[model samples]
Target chain A: MSTATATRPATPRAELAAEHGLSPSSARPPLPQYLRQVWARRHFITAFATSRTATLYSGARLGQIWQVLTPLMNAGVYYLIFGILFSSRRNIDNFTAFLVTGVFLFTFTQRSVTSGARAISGNLSLIRALHFPRAALPLAFTIVELQQMLVSLAVLGVIVLLTGEPITWAWLLVVPALILQTIFNTGLSLAIARIGARVPDVSQLLPFLTRTWLYMSGVFFSIPQRVHAGPLQDLMMANPATVYIELVRDALIDRHDAPQHAWILAVSWAVVAFCVGFWYFWGAEEKYGRG
Target chain B: MADIQHTNGQVPTVIVDDLHIVYRVYGATVGKGNAPAAFKRILKRQKSPALREVHAVRGVSFTSHRGESIGLIGRNGSGKSTLLRAIAGLLPPTRGAVFTDGQPTLLGVNAALMSDLTGERNIILGCLAMGLTPAQAKERYDDIVEFSGLGEFIDLPMRTYSSGMQQRLRFAIAAVKSHDVLLIDEALATGDADFRKRSEERIRELRDEAGTVFLVSHSLDVVTKTCTRAIWLDQGSIKMDGDAETVVNAYSSATR
Candidate 1:
């Protein structure tokens, strides 16, 4: 314990002022500086994301096996309902592969958005305790979803091969389609993260929204054959989820042909969502930790 | 009471000017007199919920210079933690301003460390969060471990450690880098006597190196012993600010 009671001799305020500059320090840092800070902590961001991914299924009895099992189980249910019961696979060749791709891709976006909404709100204590780039939380959540998707992708490839689709150079197009889908998912994650921090209850409403989107995205059945040509058809085709899912099905399965502008629409939606979502989230950076 | 200003050659590291922090607490209960009206409002499903505004810190102002250890002594809910958080830039000020010469590091107890991770991993994570590169954090790893005294237990998950051990580790990680401004909130309250002594010594060394420290503690004895100056707060306002011994004495007598 420092029990030094004697006060030190006073010094002139002018001399003190001359030695150091004084300015308000609590204001948000400039945009470039903030970007630089985020860039500098890139390693921490990746590590955090990886660690969360590693522990995500730690509590479950099956652990990481669930990652592969989840999407496969969903595909099984969809096949039983749409392929067997409804006979929706009438016109489509290799209907199993098509349904598997649709379910896997659509679920990737759904999981990313739902988990991303909880990113900031879930880590409020971490946000309050330490100073770092707030964007890292949502980015980490997206990475976790991405890691799970990689597992699902492996299973999807095996399913497509087992269904007797010949290996072709066009199969490599799945890579680009996946990359675009990931960007779109990242953007949606960031947008939902900001809203989740504010409303908190938005998370409860997300599942319904994603379910509606999943059905409209042509995951279980072919939208073009079912819906007639009109503004509604155009709107469905324009949806980025539908565009990306259709692109993947076209690339992996030989019978289906994607629209001429599918690639254009996919890339455009990815870039626009990323830019708009990032800007919206950054605008609320300083307000995230407090009410 | 007369205000005591530091006129020493040391530069002012923190200047908190007329700071006011307001908290908007939602779902406030309606009073007895308005029971029927509240029931009617609830039945109609009002768009805006009931809210009560709490003035946590009201127009408190002070200046702290380099090489000074100031203690903020207050009762529960006197806004001591809120004021420290505002200075650290974690909480935006509702009004007024806080100016500082350098970045302020707030020593938050166990809040930043992941419970499932080993103590060693948390040390690395915490260092990275404080803006240290991976290499720099690695370089300081041994020193931080030694300071924390967690030695062999560092390999175990943090959830296995006692709260006191966790707090010590947190303090060790925050103290690894000599900060220009450090805000401590009840960090010393959990540690044992030996740890407290070493923490006080470290604080003195920081002051000697021209660092500024703000300690918010309920223990007046700790304040008088470790801090050179003290500011006593009551009901979100400063009641006294002077020599640590004088303020502590006054505060103790008034409470008794």
Candidate 2:
């Protein structure tokens, strides 16, 4: 995301005086500088991608098939246990697809945020020694998770087709919805990464966070139907996750309108979550670089 | 004045001023009135000390021009590593400013590194971490591998390498940068005598190309040989700053 700029901060060693736009006291590179860092580290990502696709796929029991089959298996297990045995399928149409969409999106967010949270803390050596932007830490995890989620996306499309959820222009809104979701994840990932790094306890609590998040994020039930009547419904609707899931459901399940103001709400929530998360994360940038 | 103009054109690779680094460790300040963590807390390792802020570095400042090789000399807890970190922009100073001409690469010596990563993979990351692009990283990949001489082991997890082997690889990776400044934190201590000799040669090449280096080492011999100047820090303050031979000799005598 960061392209190299002409006026990059050199190092902590050189004093820039008054003319350099540097306050003379500030040595750290700015935000755009971090993007350049991400660009520079593309080789690490590339090498890792090559190795991962090989090692993970080749050394596995199911090989590349696991990429598609893993999420399907996950959905099937959840569906059998919840949709059939528990009889929760009565609430939503094409319950399999509903569960799959929710599961896939929520899982993507969960993994991206949790793994990105540890991105900097885990690479203890690199962060301290390397003079690049730290934002790349979370982006790396998001990129890797997004790559893995590609298979899940394909499965999602196939599931939608088989379940006969008719594709339409409203379904095209899924692209923007997905973009918003990714943006939300990036912001949350950076924020959580900062929290997890300093506290140490956060690392252990992350799985719990993800699990609690799944239950509350409307993975099991549609928002409006799940919580009916009173302030509870209002409260649930206020949740960005509820909005995100609803937008996805709207696009995939009810795919024909011009996307109502509710998608606007989801998009707005994504922006807010990103801004809040980014600000929170950057606030800790100083702490992350310290010993 | 004139110095500011010329300085901008030929800025010192690194500058540090009135820097203090304090860490607010959530651990007991005094040992009394505390029990071992309970099971749940223990699982989370709730080893909280009566919450005191430990001051790691205090009011330190210096500037080094390109082609200058500087050494950090101090006892443990005297803030050598903290000082290097502050200078490298890895650690922000609590109450001062650090300025630089270009990005610096910090080469930590003798650190317990992951042996599971191959030397080559680590090299790619290490070089990239030093702020080189993919093509740039790839260009140095072979040179760094050859310099470290890990050959077949380049593909193996670093865990299998002995301490000495890991040090050589880390040194090669950190030093592979085309940096205006490079920070070394005793990371070269594990290399063999031959590697050290060759590594010394590379440090000079970097300097000749107008790069600056801030190296921290306990070895007086390394300081005297590798650096032109030295800052002897004590209790996080600069006690002596002069030619390497002068400051190191004075610090050694005072300690003795």
Candidate 3:
């Protein structure tokens, strides 16, 4: 080995600082700077989300067709099980429209929350290697679901129109309902992503939790008629999922009776969930990649 | 080399003060056949799972100045990677602190590039992650492709490329923008001779531009060739810190 000495005398701390500018390292960037960083990477997030959504069904023979088919198939199954076999559609006019709407809307939230939970855990390698706003992961996952939902929603509009529901002014309300629900979904996904990073098993538990949430949201049955004056009804009414579903149902279906304050409730839930979730996720920003 | 400037009087780029890092690994087995006992304990729900804490870095302190190329040499599990991670701000210190003049970019051998996306797309993603604006990423697009020497292969998915190809691509993207602090964790170990030579030249250029480089490599030859100063870490603390030749010689003799 070449035994050349490389060590030199330490520079005076003051002179070193004066001669070459130095700032303390390892400090987390301020919130505004962090947000700017995230915004600058918007193209990356969009490209990643789009690419992931495209490759989701690469192995299947049908490929991108699965995005539209999956929700329609779920609607078909629920119509079979709950509408005809169980006769839950009795006294409900245009029950097909009602069932399809419930299934499609609920699935959007379910997929968003579940996929968001896995966003950080599944991409640990990327998280460890790259340094960007960690929020981009959960946000990207939510955007994937949003894109899928848009495709599914187009099919849903045709289904409801074909099922004899007239395109009334109320149908326009679906737009605002969708906007509110998407905000709610984004917030929930952000919260779940943070939790999932810390306790990976949360992803496993999410299916059952979302399933229970599905039933409570009245995807197949009407909650107001069956359960009257109980805490369960109150819980269902207060649920963001249920409120959003009710808003969509009231707007799209004729006979469905949504609460008078459903829109207000939906907006409140969306705003609160989004603010709280974003704060919760940002608080643990530095801890996301490290074990 | 004109690019290799002395950093004696420069401001310290990195200051690690009595840094301590502990990794909490759950359910570490003490011995064989303890599974049944552990299962029963879990079945009873007495408490949560067992916890084993690994002290990866124990009170290590070092000051590195701009324009210095420092090599960290240690065996597996010696906490070299962990310390680099802590300095990168990826891993929070269990105790003490790591202060740096600017953001430290860590380029590891296993840095995740999207396998499903084309190399071109991955390049853009990597540039964005490194804080480049979309326009800047587009501006440096051709330079990155040329540096990687992927040529037409940039249009193919990253999974189709060999490991060496992937490493070169990663190095290309990271080197596209000059960073104030660059931390390399075994990134050079996988490169070919030509790639390694170019990478070493880039490190020297970065150092001359007043960037601090912390390289962790198992190959003593690479360290001796590329780094001016070497720190030998044994267990979780610095064993020796001096001229590259002296530290490498001591470490080699002791290990042999």
Candidate 4:
């Protein structure tokens, strides 16, 4: 009998639940609590990242070697075009070291953003099956890129030493610069993850967008020598990708100096991108996985 | 009034109050809402005609007490699985809410946990994702392996497993931790008889742990065997909710 059901007032049931310390199953935790939850799952996040990194090339015969090979191949192509053909390395010292550093470093951000765009959409099964903080997926994807970049970085170091660059104390600066870049990428990934979830087409659009970013960031050529000094020159130098690449370039190649404000720009970009991206992603904490 | 149903004064572990879930499906039906129609609507600054909304769970309300194994019985498209997902907090309710004493774990039959990873790794990842520390996950690893009965095949990637094997592994991993509210949707239907028997025993153990279990199964026999209470849903509303045998019987007779 439909009448057998007692329709109690909604407020009383809710109040009773609250009295018993029950919370809504679908309620998004406050930002602080959400951060704590994500922090609590750090082990899972790392494990997930490592597992994904390990399996990334499992199907290929070359397997994990591709991590080093892919970037080496990319750097080779850029060197052929920019160093030899286009001669865009004008006034730049140690072009090989410079181009490899830029490619490896910029690939970190590029892969992080591209994979971050697919982090939620790609792992809908994992997202729907588990109850951990959703941010873990994107964070894990970023770590996967970081792991790959580490291998590429090692390869970059070898190429730099081969190019006769001395291991000066300036090389110590690469660590902190990479740390800042990683933080900046983590934030960008988080923001892009949410956007990718909302708009599936973002993943498709990312390749062209990141390609534009790659060229604008001066991955191949020196921006100051090529682009005339103007507001455009200042904007290109201030771009976060260019800032990070310049920091690494200055650290690795003594002659290729970063602008005077590079360190300040790097730190501010990391903090701002992280805060803005995290806030943007967290704002839609409950909206994820919904149809 | 809810206390009347819980004569033993069992605390309520799950309270789904007038919950509603609507799924917004895009690119739905090219009949009237064709691409050109969508283009025209966009040009007219109107909402895309292709965006259709499916009201999946329409005002379903129920209270599950601690230690109760409630079977959700319904025909296809009757919102049984959707209700389970809503209770598990995976789907945001379009209206009302689902309040729980603790987190609800949903185990759908097809909820693949890293198909590329071997069953061994999947167990560890699944346990860790469920908030178990590395040490605790290791402690429960053997028991879960023993329970799953995959034997030598556990080392193989999960994608290599048959559907039944995957379900067993999923059930094993989920059963390792005692959840306050476990929402299982048709996960047990794929298991063989022996596996089913063991899972039934495990379900009883879960109930003795003072947790509420919600099982959505089309098999009335499995429901009558496993659940104390049964809810028969028709068209997203509760057609009947009572003792398992009575509800299953009424549902079967009505359908026949």
Candidate 5:
């Protein structure tokens, strides 16, 4: 160590630092090492998520009940407009169950992506103060949405039963579908976190983007009847949001049929989104807190 | 540079090599602009008229050895906090680099780690965030709680605590782990005299464990009392670097 430190008068200071076995303070670790670091902080991630979810409505009078009420109200307003006003329930049995399922499922993705935008910017204090993997913040945000999704799931079950939908053995498929949706959301949250940190204006634009996605996902209407056959219908069906919604609708509503290729598309979308999002986010790991 | 050499064959733990950190703040517009103008500017890859560049730490270099506590003394906006942030890996350097043997824990006064959470939770989360396992964090829990002297207030939300209490909790959580390098930015100033003395003793114990501590404080008395060496920075460059007493005296007399 002394030899490397002493015989380098011509060397730049960076090289001298390297000779002393020092790494850049802000350098990103290798991908595998980074993933390991994230895994080790799983306890932190879960604790943070639980705490955030608990405090999300602490200021409101309704408190945690709003967790269930917020989604129920969203479904109510959409039902009044689309179900009663526009008759978006055209040719679909159990339209109440269908619409509720769509709103709840799509909301999981919607909240994940939107909150992902704020994950870094909102938690600048925590990021600057602590030395954990920056990925934990996004992961925690995703889990917060997941906790809410679970609450919404319980409400969805009651709404489905009230709409007279049967609970077949196929209802078990909701587990796999939700699991896949979560993976996809995690990846998307990670990617959006990095983007939102760099371009804060993205947060302003996210609602519009997510709204457009919600419409394209056929959240309120039955795409099979409303959309004409061709590439357009196939494209809509292949949409990850639409795919997850359809899978859940199939499992819950006895009359609703998912596309034969739904499971394949679901798995593919989850894998692709997660891998790309993780890789893209990791690319800028070291640049998170800096201006 | 001071004639006193504290290096007793210990290897250098931190090498801040000619570090330069420039902060670009948006929304400092000189002229009013509408949406279309902003869009056109973005499309053309031209910087926003609101852009303002601040060169905070300009080519500052220093090497810190193990078991040394160095106090960074400077006036407000003189880049003292920015220098510590750069050393903690929270800020990217505009030029040159900061290299460290291990991760540096930065204890800044502004962020209490988690303000909304209870002090008890913040301790656990803060410890876990710094890579301590749940078991290790739990083991350190009582020590941190006692060190903070938060008492029953520990069970209350951190936001309810005064700034001094917040700083105490932050220091206790940070000091629990024996870091390879610890960069504290004005966190100790909020503590009362008793807390300050306790923390100074803790800082000494940390140094005895072969760790390097870089403290940025406006309190010259604290600097002279706690640090073995001191560096006075002015306008982003070291004005004087020497014995803590000598540097503090020079800085005080010169400022006077």
Candidate 6:
């Protein structure tokens, strides 16, 4: 023990350890932990990214075709009941397309957010044994969800084309919108994931919560145009999802100018969600390595 | 993340600096067997603490040079696993520091694997968890498959493997990577007599190569056969750290 205590480390371990008293020890991890994590699973993440994405599409026999088809089918069913049945007293042109895109995107965000709720608890083995960014869990989750998003987008694109919505410059906004949506999803997901690990009840109610949220998201109505008709409508329209869905729809489908408040709402929601989620998740950094 | 390969070729391989570790368990759905069946407890409804705290590892400090094979002998709840976990950096010490030459692998009694995934997929994930690169993992894949002896069943889900089989596969994966320091948490009992002998030979080879190994096991036979040194832990403190047989013999005699 005395012999072990006599020696001191000589090599630079990490910048954080050298410059600051942060990280595990005064020394940096010899091999970058990130490199180790990536090295360990380069093949797996890649294979999973491609294989799961492809297989998840369940494609060849309209197998994964359900990726896109499932949302569209839901949209069509809802459109018949809501647009044609109960709301038949009113009128809105191209209502099915608008509703489907909104419904589809809302579902993507909801699924991405809630699935992250189970991320840490589900991977207890890896977390307890290995040291990597716990962020990796939600990031992988976001990637998988993005795969579903791509399938949904393909479906929505075909519908937009068939509905005679011509391609235009506004389509460029979709890329940024998609990127913002991903960041927003990651933020919200991490936030939910932290609490969900400690509170098992959160996972149980996640499906119900998401279902209830969809109604308030205005996927079945002209939320932007008639957004202030009642307190309920006003409240729904105020939701960040409402702004996101309308912004995407306005740019891609309606080919109209977005409301003045849309960007304000979207950007604030994203920033708050990102900062709040990242810090909240980081605060629980200790739990991840525990069994 | 700390490595201490000596320029003078005499560096210690592992170090613990006043290390402490903590764990908090929450929302455990304890079955209600302890609850009163009738109105006997109605007058005294209990509202106990929700967060159960276990001081698994206390202010522990120790280190080992490159060739040391140290065994930890202790009772079931005697903090042996917790100390191993702290040294492995699996659980960060709450009050101190652990600096090792490199990362270690801690394989406990329960072989932890993603049950839904096949043994082969788990093999890949296991290697990755140990920090092996994809190409390196690929190169080592054949050897790993052969060593586990699970054979064709390697492609089947790990949940299907017997607990013993799972342990063997885990050992195979963790052993593929060389470490400046390696920690085993009572992971013996994976195979029959011959395989244990092979594992002992492998540990000897690793020690001769100047790698440090930390093993925690209740079996005195394992400590006697494999370790150069041993530490006896009880109630989160070291009772002894010295020659393996001498320490185990003392502890065993006292307990008896």
Give model 6's TM-score versus the native structure. 0.79
**Alpha-carbon runs more than 4 Å astray in model 1:** A1-20, B1-8, B29-50, B110-112
Instruction: Please give the lDDT score at residue B155 for candidate 6.
Output: 83
Which of candidates 1 and 2 reaches a greater lDDT? Answer: 1
- Give the DockQ of candidate 3: 0.37
User: Which prediction has more favorable TM-score, 1 or 6?
Assistant: 1
Better of 2 and 3 by TM-score: 3
Predictions' DockQ, in order:
0.37, 0.31, 0.37, 0.53, 0.56, 0.23
Name every residue pair that clashes in candidate 5: none
Give the per-residue lDDT of model 3 (tens digit) for B221-252.
98998898999999999999889999999999
Q: Find the 10 residues in a row with the least total lDDT in model 1 chain B.
A: B1-10
Error of 2 at A16 (Å): 9.7
Candidate 4: which pairs clash?
Answer: none
Model 5 lDDT tens row, B188-243:
99899999999999999998899999999999988998899999999999888878
Candidate 1 structure quality by residue, lDDT tens digits, B189-237 = 9899888888888888887888998999888878888899999888888
Task: Kindly report the fnat of each predicted structure, to 2 decimals.
Answer: 0.53, 0.40, 0.55, 0.62, 0.71, 0.19
lDDT of 1 by residue, A196-268 (tens): 9999989899989999999898887888889999999899888988999999999999888998799999999
For model 3, how does the per-residue alpha-carbon lDDT over A1-291 read when each residue is reduced to its tens digit?
001101222334323433455533444566788778778778878878888887788779999999889988999999889987998888677889888988999999999999999988889878878778889999999999999999999999999989988888998899999999999998999999999999988978998999989988877887776679689898888798888888888898887778878878998999998988887888788788864
CAPRI grade, predicted model 5: medium
Using DockQ as the measure, name the better of candidate 2 and candidate 4.
4
Question: In order, what are the TM-scores of chain A for the candidates?
Answer: 0.91, 0.80, 0.90, 0.95, 0.95, 0.77
lDDT of 6 by residue, B40-69 (tens): 435567543344777777766665776889
Candidate 4 lDDT over B1-256, as tens digits, reads 4533553456888887777777888886655755676677778997765678888888877777889999999899999999988888888777777789989999997688998889999999999999999999999999999999999999998899999999999999999999998888899998999999999999989988999999999989999999999999998888899999999999999999
**Candidate 1, DockQ to 2 decimals?**
0.37
lDDT of 4 at A153: 85
Highest TM-score model number? 4
Which has the greatest DockQ?
5
Task: Give residue B130's lDDT in candidate 1 (0 to 100).
Answer: 83
TM-score of each: 0.91, 0.81, 0.91, 0.96, 0.95, 0.79
